[model samples]
Target: MIKCCNYDRKYPMAWDREDFSRAYRRLAPVYDHGLLLYELVGMRLRRYRREAVAGLHLQPGDTVVDLGCGTGVNLPLLLGAVGPTGRIIGVDLSPEMLEQAQRKIDAEDWCNVELVASDMVDYVFPPHVDAVLATLALATIPDYDSVIRTIASALPPGGRLANFEMTWPEAWPDWLVKLGAKLQQPFGVTTDLKDRKPARSIQRHFARCDSSERYFGAISFCIAIRQAGTGVNV
Candidate 1:
């Protein structure tokens, strides 16, 4: 279940936050199952998630914020990275989504996790947050630019942010890209996804941002470190 393809776009009208909220409300229960649709296309979801978590470079007892943490899909991986002593803060806008995540926590009997219902943009990063992660979540934001910058400003020294997301593929044939866009429409994704890339924003704030692309440019993974002194107050 991709909790994090958090959203934003240049054209604010592309997707209303309320609309996504409703979509997730209906999708909450079936979210994990629905993720199989990607696997059918060879998405290798678990592998990607593991790779993203590894990029965080977490240490035992380190804290991580899972932005747009849909249904807590990343919880186990994060908890594994930081161990029992470490803490995980999972945030999402959909209450129902959080409910589903809570169920998972209860079933697993994990005690170091916290779930918060809030939009990523207005989410207040608590003190000592070692890292922030947004998986499949950032592109959905209406102003990902500000969201990324604000998170950068809020992190302590050496803190990092890792964002993983999909985009309209540049390497695909024109006809294929169109077909892909149509398929994503039911999820409220528009042709605007082609312009939803946030790599530039990550590079702007971090002196060094590492990036990788997969699925022929349709998928991206980026990790940026907030240099000792960069960013303005959020």
Candidate 2:
């Protein structure tokens, strides 16, 4: 039975690291290609990813952290944003996913990038970070709100973070919402995901939060800003 698919639903499920880790480990090697295959579903993920990074407007020397950095698909686009002097910290709970990401780092000889195998809930933020990027990720973490708070306070004034994710349409009928949940089950998407609202958290923590939806409201991308320092530097 589907409850109302609004963002106000109570008691969403928590992140089950063991189960999701196993699923992602198995999917790690194919993850990069796997996302692209969603093209058949009319998701232009590559383009969306590029736009997500571009929204950060990171400078040549800024540091950025990528949470749930599966196979490091966002690394290249991030590298392009910050240039050679910037640092990237990619965090994930799946070692297999980190391994695939490491391969990308090695293949490109990216000396400034670091990959850590840790859940985003426990991952620590480094100082002097100018931005954070989480693409198709935050909704999967049960404690994403806490993470958002940490980023908000730790970032030097005006630091940026981008969230790009999958979501139900704004006004889906109950039957359609149920069908959508069923179709997403194989990818580990759950009904409780409907209750996760990272944007609201972002709005609560950051001084400025700007968001837009695309793909018929099935996708939301938000860029948030902390208070104090201006854009350009951290």
Candidate 3:
């Protein structure tokens, strides 16, 4: 049965690495094409990012890691928030996407940003980050629990994890949801998580979790933090 607020049919299945790799390689060239649809979605994500990061109360020189950074869209905002003294590390799996991000960094001459092309789920940072964010990338990863566990293990108590994902719309007519799902199939986009139990999976690693659905049924933002007794040490 589908959950009330969030329904996801994607969980019971997993996609292989080759499949994910191919998609990333293919998306490298036309990534911007799909992003046009996200103009409204982007605004919503930005708001959530700003709110979540600001709530972290970062100092002038705090550090943050952008998991699945994908062309570094959030790099500029993160740079401004963290200030010149702080650092922003962007991690992604696509080299082509990272190349575009690199060009942007060079063109803008942003000294506080660092881009790393690697699978965020497996990449290890020497020093733990103060905050971690993954915008819409979590939904694509097959290993949701492991990814959350990795992020939780890499942050200190009170460190924040802000995630933006595509969620199923609740209260919408069932026909609309079904129609949307059918429309996305041709493009290989799945709407299963719009109804999946992301919160339940999150709760396994985080002591506190809260979510907000925004953009009139297009996106979901989840903010989770490790609690004091969770034994999450930096």
Local distance difference test scores for all models: 0.82, 0.80, 0.70
TM-score of each model, in listed order: 0.89, 0.89, 0.79
- Determine the C-alpha RMSD for candidate 1 after optimal superposition of all C-alphas: 4.4
Candidate 2 ranges with C-alpha deviation above 4 Å:
1-15, 229-234
Give the Å error, residue 152, model 2. Answer: 0.8
Local distance difference test, candidate 1: 0.82
| Candidate 1 lDDT, 48-90, residue by residue in tens | 8998899889999999999999899999999999999999999
Top candidate by lDDT: 1
Pairs of colliding residues, candidate 2 = none
Lowest summed lDDT window (length 10), candidate 3:
1-10
Better of 2 and 3 by lDDT: 2
The TM-score obtained by model 1 is 0.89
Ranking by TM-score: 1, 2, 3
Please write out the lDDT profile of model 3 over residues 96-134, one tens digit for every residue: 778878888999999989888888678897485888878
